[model samples]
Target: MKKIIGVDLGGTTTKFAILNEAGEIEQKWSISTDIEREGINIVPNIIDSINQQLSQSGLSSTDVLGIGMGSPGSVDIDKGTVIGAYNLNWKTLQQVKEQIEAGTSIPFYIDNDANVAALGEQWKGAGEGNANVVFITLGTGVGGGVVAEGKLVHGAGTAGEIGHMNVDPNGYECTCGNVGCLETVASATGVVHLAQDYAEGYAGDSELKGLIDQKQEITAKIVFDQAKKRDPLAKKVVDKFSFYLGLACGNIANILSPNAIVIGGGVSAAGDVLVDGVREYFEKYAFPPVKTSTEIKLAQLGNDAGVIGAGSLVKMSR
Candidate 1:
């Protein structure tokens, strides 16, 4: 059976996998991303990794169909170039596809990291068998992808940026230099910021307050844990977080009207607590038809979403 290579590149590490057309991973591993020298080393490192894996598995380049990759920032998919990946300190466009293809003599396909994750879910996870869906990732930052009418919406190569949707006019400024973006209130960092703001003024007793008083770092998990215990401050923060998240989902629903919204990333590990809270608000703010039509659920693929989605790209092309 023909196999394909899938790569999920991040600021800190890059995940690599070998998978068959069925989307089952045969081998998977990761390596630290060397962003030194304007990320010039990234492609070479990936090529070396792929070759090493192939050697260990006693496979050859001819045994693979192609390679698919997910990366951060805007991508010129048609041109096979990355417009920009700020987190990787890639300040300028990079010829990622060309470099990889040249190194391995194999074809390469690429897309934004979030978009590929969405495609992954659509192929084999929560969105299995569904053509239209939205995939949202709530990690240190928020990222989103949308598929409409059985097609991924590239929208001039910058579509599916759900994180930047202005949800708060007077909210905190986002790293993207936007004010009150959905990412500012719903991302992991946003959750911690909300908890910190509440803990500062809270005179009442709460574990969140204790964490603040002890000068310990506050995290979304800590807030959720306290909220589960019914701590007033944590509950308030979680409620606010859920409300903002719901409002964002409602807005997306009104715009795209996708069949399902799949939530993923590290923060999503909170599971039902997070999904239930967001759903409560999503139903309230969504348009009448949207509220009834869209099914909000957790991402089933977890960390594998990126690679699986990338691998599926090869299948999609055929």
Candidate 2:
């Protein structure tokens, strides 16, 4: 039974999984990223961990077919080099790859984590069987990926950056150095900021305000809980959040014309309130064909998508 190692590296935590050739996850594990201490040390440590995992089952490095990884940054897939990840504080993937290969013989593959997640959905999750799909991850900030013509679009490191797309010229400033980027009003940070702004005059009796200890520490989850409890301020905040989110989705749909759009990430935990709102706004704003043709669905793989997608890419690249 040939198996591939999937490693999904994040700023806080890195997830690992052993996936079979048929797309089944046979085993999984996790660990803190801790890349800030010595970013170059991650590769060898990861290799040791994978070997340790296989040892438990009387398996050796030879039993593993390949390694696939998803990280945060621009990756040159053709060269297996990660240009640099602002979040990971790493400049190259080749060094990381060389370190791992020095201890192990299996070939390794890598890509941007968002692109990996999109590939995961397309290959084995929500967008399974679809040739084209887009994944939008709404977390502290927005991240997105596009899969078209049965492939993840890699337009010279410029692909899958929809979050930076400007949705409002007169809106809030985005950390990406853009004014009114879509993420400014649609991500978790955006949602919380919107909630706080809306809670200005109604700060006294607002359920959201009551739930948090300090008014300055309110979160999008807090607003979501309040909305679930029927708080008017929360509802207004969510409505605005969804409106912008949907507008962004509609624009992506109109431009890309993907078969489906998959939504994921932490903010997606809000469930129906978040999804329904986006759907409503999407239908209203998208062009007729786009509105009726493209289906929007929630991602099913959750945290495992990155690793699975990364590992799967190894097989595809072969």
Candidate 3:
């Protein structure tokens, strides 16, 4: 039976999975990313882990179709190079393909982490059977990917950067050195920021206010939990977060008009609360045609989206 390896490379850990052509995970595991030497050992470490897994499974090189990987930072897919993955201390373009191929002697395909996640969702998760879709991940920072006309759109190798979409020119500054990017208002950090800002002037009684009084750090989960309980301040924070997220989605709808907008990541764990709230605003801000055409939903793949999407990359290339 032919199998493929799916790799989700993150700043701290790298997840690996073996999948058959049917997209079922036969086995999966992970290893801590070795970034001690400017990430020089990252690729080598990945190769070693792969070899170990293959040996343990009694699988040979010929039985494997290829390897697919999802990595952070800008990627030159054609060259299999990472332009810059700052979190991994990769400041220069690294020859990810050549290095990994040299080690494993298998063809490798790579893409931006967000893009692969979107691909994964489209293949077997929330966007399954849909050719046109957009995936937004609201984690520590926002990330986005777009699949248009049954293909991943990578115009100039920088397509689907939904998080950087300018939402508020005068709003909070984003880590991307921009003011009020969608990430600043719709991500996990953004939610907490909104909660803190709302608490400053809120005189009403709320659990968030008590946390503030106690100098306890507030999180997006806390805000969502409080809002579900009808805490006024937390509700306000959620309302603001949803508004910006919806506005961004509306803009995307106007531009791409995909079949569905799939939401994922840590913040999305809030489930219906987050999806329903964003849909409300998306409908309000989007054009009528776009509003009715696009469906908003949560991603079903969870952490597996990355690995499955990576595996899909190999299948797509074949």
Candidate 4:
């Protein structure tokens, strides 16, 4: 009957789940993330929802052991402080955690969202049973998490940032104020950018061209579908993007030497087309022993990884 609360805070939504000590979800809910307000303001909404759910279940806040939150910023884990969350406009992690704790007496634990997702995957998803693993999330923006030596590598809260690594130094500008970051070429948005660049000079007839009108709604999904149908231009775009992604994975492997690389996010739905291309390219780009040693697999946790990982914070902290 023991329970814990897991909070996954994102730019659009804040997902919460009540999990038993044995890892079963008792209830789940969500609220708008309120990007316009300061990060601290969202805390009361979260607490209120948790309390409502607990009351509906004939329980109380005291029945829960603690709360864990996955945030989108650098965190000082030891201090329970958020060092910087420019996107959330939060000045510190400690302030956000304290605000949430102030709403209740339970202990709170927080970490970067991607890192937490990695832990979630390791605990119950694709990375299960693997002590060393790399998790890459390919969404509007790319994010990553690393597990090494049976532990999540924090490296002072800045560790698993494969997205910001320089992949194409002269290619595109990223929101992180970097030029040619891996995220610029390997994320869902990155794929769209590559598709647009390819569509401009594409002469071959294809269904993709007809799908989007004058506005160039070129999305990653369409490009993936076209690639699935063997469209040459779409295939080229995917390959180009995949090559950079493979190279980035290889680099991460070389440094971390993880047992597996788990890729998540919407774009991963492309399945084998994405996996094979990344693996093939990794063989060509990766360092000697690194390429041969690591196992590359798609993440299995999907949307639940964030909250699931949040739920397992107690394990990660130890």
- TM-score of each candidate structure, all chains considered together: 0.93, 0.91, 0.96, 0.89
User: Per-residue lDDT for 29-140 in model 2, tens only?
Assistant: 9987657644766666788888788888777778888899897777776566775776666765446566666677778888888899999988898899898899999888
* lDDT (Cα, 0-100) at 82 in candidate 3: 96
lDDT of 3 by residue, 141-192 (tens): 8998999999998987688888899988899988888898999878888898
- Over 1-318, each residue of candidate 4 has an lDDT whose tens digit, in order, gives 668888898877899888887656778888987655566666677778777777888887688888888987777676677756777667644466676677776778988899999988887888888899899999878888888887888775578788898988788999999899999988888988887777777777866655543665778988988899998888888899888989888888887888889999888888889999999888887788888789889998788888888988955554
Model 3 misplaced stretches (Cα beyond 4 Å): none
Model 2 alpha-carbon drift over 4 Å, by segment: 60-62, 83-94, 201-205, 209-216
Instruction: State the lDDT of candidate 1 residue by residue for 1-318, as single tens digits.
Output: 999999999999999999988888989999999999888898899999998889899998999999999998788787788866887889888998898999888889998899999999998899998889999999988988888887888886678778898888999999998799988888898999998888888999887899888999888998888888998899999999999989989989888888899999888988898899999999999999999899899999998999999997777777
Judging by lDDT against the true structure, name the best candidate. Answer: 3
> What ranking emerges by lDDT with the best candidate at the front?
3, 1, 2, 4
Model 1 quality (TM-score):
0.93
| Model 4, runs deviating above 4 Å | 34-40, 83-94, 209-214, 287-289
Q: After superposition, how far is residue 79 of candidate 3 from its true place, in Å?
A: 0.8
Higher-lDDT candidate among 3 and 4?
Answer: 3
Sorted by TM-score, highest first, which candidate order results? Answer: 3, 1, 2, 4
Instruction: Give the root-mean-square deviation of each candidate in angstroms.
Output: 1.9, 2.4, 1.4, 2.6
